[model samples]
Target: MNKKLTLSLDDQVIRKAKAYAKINNVSISQLVETYLGEVINDDEPKLTGVVAELAGIIPDQEYDKMEYLQNKFS
Candidate 1:
């Protein structure tokens, strides 16, 4: 089942969306539908137990993954 939708968007945005749809071989409606579907269905997984407790314990920062693995395994 499909329903018709009317949207008011900027002219430049509409042009860009049409160009993007054409390049990707999909209709603008399809892009909008997919985006809306993702938005509507977006759900974050619920963490539990120790994992939940550890969440955000480490401050967000960049680290060398190779060094970390080498230290862990070697």
Candidate 2:
């Protein structure tokens, strides 16, 4: 049992979505359905104890991965 949905989107977004759907061999409706399902089903596991306590202790920062790898391996 499915219902029709009307969406208002930019023309460029619709064009891109159509191309993506065609390449993936799915209808635009299916793509939207799958995305909505994932978003609605937010069932992520919760960390506990030490892991939960340590989470977010470090401030968000970006570092050069290549530099770290070269220093580590070379």
Measured against the true structure, the TM-scores of the candidates, in listed sequence, are 0.61, 0.59
Candidate 1 residue 52 Cα shift, in angstroms, is 22
Which segments of model 2 are wrong by more than 4 Å?
Answer: 45-74
lDDT tens per residue, model 2, 30-56:
999998887788599667799999999
lDDT of 1: 0.92
What's the lDDT for all of these models?
A: 0.92, 0.91
lDDT tens digits, residues 1-74, model 1? 99899999999999999999999999999999998887788797667799999999776997888998999999
Distance from true location, Cα of 5 in model 1, Å? 0.7
- Candidate 1 error regions (>4 Å): 45-74
Give the Å shift of residue 36 in candidate 2.
0.1
Worst 10 residues of 2 by lDDT: 56-65
